[model samples]
Target: MNIQKMKELIDKLSQASRAYYDEDKPIMSDKQYDALYDELAALENSTGIIMAGSPTQKVQGSVSEAFEKVRHSEPMLSAQKTKDVNEVVSFAGGREVNVSWKLDGLTLVLIYDGGTLQKALTRGNGEFGEDVTANARMISNIPLTIPYKERVELRGECLISWKAFDEVNTDGEYSAARNLAAGSIRQLDPMVTKSRKLSFIPFKLISPARTTKSEDLKWLASLGFDVVENINAASNLKEVIKQFAPEKYDYPVDGVIIEYNDNQYARSLGTTGHHPNSIIALKWADETYETQLTGIELNPTRTGMVSLKAVFKGVDAGGAILTKATLHNVDYMKNLQLGVGDTITVYRANMVIPAIDDNLTRSDTYELPKTCPCCGEPLEIRLAETAHFLWCTNKECPAKQVRKFSYFVSRPAMNILGLSDKILEKFLSLGLIKDFSDIYELSMHKDQIVSLDGFGEKSYLKLIDAIEKSKDVEFSHFITSMAIPNVGTSSAKTIAAHFSTYEDFRNAAVNDDFDFTELTDFGGTVADNIYNWFADKKNVEEFDKVKSHVNIIYPEKKQTNANFEGKTVVVTGKLVNFTRDGITKELENMGAKVSGSVSKKTSFLIVGADAGSKLKKAEELGIPVISEEAFKNMI
Candidate 1:
């Protein structure tokens, strides 16, 4: 082995590892990194010369200047992960083990003393971590006080749910749930952590050890900790794999964890520098289905970015027929050498999202589009930090306005029922609607609308009624419906909560009297977006027109009720006495925040018949549950 080549590999791998584990960006694919790591390990073994900086020889830690560093009492080791089920089965040796989701988020260690939470630390390397106690305290699922009086410690994952992730990720700045969760947790302001709605699910009890893993999890739940859901006891790895379905989970999960039930026996098995021998992670095999790429479709987004979608022959993947997958950006397409008529292998990432795994036939013959498909204007390639994307150069592109209008009437926004994107496209083509205000005036074209292919007398009447009903909208909904750049439902809610009324907010924005940057999680970018949107004459005119036809109801001042004060409640399934919105509003009026998922902070989970994962999670977390009748009686 050449020493110089070995040294170069070490440096390259180290840099990539740091980028992946620390910065939440992978410079190379997992397969590429693993192959290079294997080569480096083999060279070291053959030459009997291990370089000091070799990734195999030591553990690397990330550095963040914002937080104070603290040493961990026990090392937090990574699990040995494998894509092969055979290896997992061989390691298990037919022993009964607990199978649970390997949550794709930041690892956190919590310490409790005298029945009160003491500290929370990130899993920085293994020996030390940055102190994140303040941010941890803001996590909805972290318990400030536990029932156990003795000093105890726990380890878990801090994660964001897909719903909350989507609500705040309007700008598409973060790519994955794990990346968003990591970034949210590392914020200098704890208010950012609170707004992100982070949750902690304990997987391990570090201190006051129990005999079995099941017992430990139960104990953790008893102490008011949200525990990871235990699927079932599996005697073999095959059973574990069969039971591991990531789609059913509310939170994002990268893989499944199979750990020995006997805690003492597993601990005795000992550790490596990187991972312990007791547990192994079973990652989803990249089972790729080959399909021929038919073509690529570029769709203009509300932000003027033309998103590329690959049209491919239909293939079954993860129980779904996938005909199209997002190409992500120009760089991704170029790297894959993707082209029309190429044989591409497609798979479902995490058994949910369809993705292109590889292009077997690197047919680089496909030409990139030089003009915007919608506007007939020349396209511009814009460079982001590490990627390049095609953007529509036309500022007044009709496709952009259509996308924005679609988003404005989306469920999270104004929620104009019975108006589908296809219908909107038709209306746009007919010049019946151009802006959001045109939606209210849609009744004027009722005769024309009813004459359309899908629209009839009944459907047109229903749409008109929905439009009328939507005029009495909440302040947050109105704000979200404006389609301000980078401003989504969550940020709109924050703004509504601060200003209380639409008039107050508008006055402050128009006069430039208030600094939006002072709001929690509202940085300079968000402030600029809000200011610029309000400053635009066209936007102001459109907003004024919409406001004239709508009644923006400000949120009521919450009443301090002993039953629900300062409580976080989650409602699941169908309600009998109250509609979903009604019950949520009632809870909010009583000084409770309604959350979608169950956690330790969830004071009550109102479950109904046909309840789903939230009920199961509430039970696992040992949260108090109530029926609709019981909830009504309490109120």
Candidate 2:
């Protein structure tokens, strides 16, 4: 290995990582990329000049600015992907090519150094990633400590279950499961992340080495971790795709991965600018069908928007399987020439979301609905920037109320126990809950609640107790329960902390004298929303009713300028002294601002065990890095 060549390769790889991470486009294939990375790693190991933030020692960087930076014991590299089967066959030569599902979820790298869960990270730019150890701990399937207890780092996708997705989408407007899973993992509240029921399926071993992919799955399974064990070894590319077709699986997988089973052979093959030359992914070929629409169904959603669902006869295009299609909005309908009795071609667009590919046949007699199906109210076609939808006239629709109420009592808000959609629906049907405020008056329906199906004497009492206990919620929780647009629980907490009480917030919003600019991160949009929410008399009346029944609690204001008052602290990694959340709360209470990452302005980096990259960065920049225990002592 030439030292000069290694330096050149490292510099090129760094440039490539920057291009991919910052630009969202790859400069080279995964195999070519991984080969260069391996070359650099081997060179560095032989001649010890590994950079502090080199790709050879850290996980890849992610896109979002929300998460904390974590240093990986072993850096995550991009996987090789290939659409052609000939490529897979070529890689295998005469040997068998293994086919498996390619999950489209956030890639999580979990490192267990010294028999404890050390760090968790997202693949950002194939060099540095966002630290998400706290969020990973909340995911049940990710083991806190593996049984082997040996130093090891594993890679997997953090995903939300389909059942949980439907449950969370009671309001019928949550984004795709992958989006929600990614969003939930980065949430500030551990409780909020926990309620998401995220699961991890360890797919690859990052460290402690590996020989075969089967052996890697076995190793993960030994630790009681779920591993995707769907492997089909085939002699050729056609056989690989046929065996691992999308139709064969119950769940969704983007493509099939084919990698060399032998670790030595894989290492010999090596990496490129963005992928491994040794591994190849066979993306499934999408099938399309041409069919005629029988009728259009106007489904009224919880938000009072009437969706245009096309009921079409089965159509087949190539090998793609799609029966029902989404019109999305009235604009999509008009653009696609979709109406009752119109002939259309359907295909799995990008082999994912089912879409109307084209209109093959047109019918002049097709008609559009003028009124909503549910309430028989006149529907209004409203346009935002890009699209238009039919909105129902009735504002107090039952579906809307139920959706709003469910969100109000969600884990982010009051977190009342035993409050589900079924129970809420039953209560609503009985004219018990008309708004979110109606939930506070449920004590009056004790006898009626106990009599409902699935509710017995013991259960009913517990539910009432849960509601009663929620009355003493902090001002932040109280604000979240209102379900104001764009104001999530974390934002509500930031606002509540600045205001100190609900009255202060109300006065600021209603009186218009308070300067919202004083609050850090508070923008005009948020302030306008606060003002608008209080401006509505109905909202005020509802809030008053809720306030009357539930006693909102406030924490004692912290004494200003305590120890570490003037000093800026950047908290990183898993804290042994306190939960990362606990330490953050204490630090904020003591008048210190807890920042997400390090800067030249950062006074100190309060680090915990397994305090990866940020600690290294702090050291390189000459910033003081202290342990959690030491931080407690200082306080």
Candidate 3:
């Protein structure tokens, strides 16, 4: 442990960080990176010689400042971190570590002048950030008014809702939730930001300077602000991260953060220029290995495209051995130069799914199957605008039918409770269901379902009741359940609202006049997909079957006063008196349009307790704003 060695180790770690953040590629494995970082620390400790520009001292300047720089009242210190549990134990000298979810989101500093939110800034370059006060107000989770209107500043992560992300991103191209959240926060237009369904969950009270650690989470929760809960208190980092790493997650997370909870202890520990000595981020060590591909299996999709499924020699993924990884399509296989008997580096990308990172051997070559795996029909290679895909000409593939049925029972579609994959498969095998529409006819076989292994008379009757209830669905759900290509819930709603009736929609499809331009969210790609879906005779037949069995419930009309006729109402956040949809429906019923975003023409921006960004925009636009309670009374 010498000065020279320390300098070399620091240089290596710094280079690694730069490579990861700048290039989106890691030069060293997580374990190797940590070992280097630890060696640097050990050298510094033994020699008492801290390098002038050590990686341990200063936070790497990565994100460029997008606004004016402001020196924090208390310098926003970066957390001290260790991915290894035993290393954290060594670092802490066996002290307790409080572990929590390191939410992948935009960090915001909220300043309260007197009792009002004065300004909110993003963690841009750790010094400066764009003033996003107007946009921040529209987020549903942040409280507009707090118990302590007394000057206090808070630090938290602003995130996107799981459901909201799916709704806004009609195109399923967003790779990570954090990326989508960052894009939403950086949107130039307030309306665009408002529509994204961003929410804030405060983790720290940065200012109004408390002497103690504050245990502020409970207090914030009481004030109706969303707070991230600490899951485990462990003596080591390993136990803590294991506690946090559940089987599945809706949002993507990179690491777990562990910090000293005692305020005085944290203060006494002090901080380096980069991260606090009291806090540290622990990243999971992804296990990777070279595996040989056994063969490529093509699974035909409902879109008539055969997706390449790669069967690799069993590789451990998140503690489980997995043998198959989806190649996505024929182009994916070709792009990666994948072949049977070729060794490929397989690892869980973000600890979610097994992905072939790179091919290690190309001594032997394999070709895409000429025949469809399911139907044994000759495969046709189509040169799509983006890439080549193996097309399965057979439209009635069982795999495709199963997928359609799965979507129909999914939450976004008909939401038929208790109709899972097992039941659907059973019904399909029994010849009770062969298509998505066949679900509507399930009630006819209630007696037969009761006799099935897992089901008794009571369970079968309950499932039948749920299916029968799902028959009378909202217009949006009904349209979504149709399994129209690219017609997701949001797009479906737009189409439903535009057409007003199922008959009108069908007629428009028949006449080739289903113009989607007028709809708020519909794009050319979605419109074209819709047209293609309806044009198929088989799809039309399936639609007819479901249409005959189910009842579509349009927006119920209320007695209109025309008092707020043509006036735009922007509703923000969870209403205590009503749900978001309920408020929108009531407003629309009253001859006012319930818009997704705040605009200059918006007459009223109805806000709830934690109304975040919309209220900020209303203030900026000099538009009048009302609370949910006030809105209820007013209406």
Which one is best on TM-score?
Answer: 1
Per-residue alpha-carbon lDDT of candidate 1 for residues 218-283, written as tens digits (9 for 90 to 100): 888777676898754656558657866788778988789989989989989998887888999888
| True-structure lDDT of candidate 2 | 0.69
Give the CA lDDT, 0 to 100, for residue 374 in model 2: 50
lDDT of 1: 0.81
Q: What is the C-alpha RMSD of each candidate to the true structure, in Å?
A: 4.4, 15.4, 10.8
In model 2, state the lDDT of residue 102. 78
Point out the worst 10-residue segment of candidate 3 by lDDT.
20-29
Off by over 4 Å in 2: 1-62, 71-80, 232-250, 292-323, 326-343, 348-353, 358-395, 402-635
lDDT of 3 by residue, 526-565 (tens): 5677678778888788778888888889866555645467
Relative to the true structure, how large is the alpha-carbon lDDT of every model? 0.81, 0.69, 0.68
What is the lDDT for 199 in model 1? Answer: 85
lDDT, candidate 3, equals: 0.68
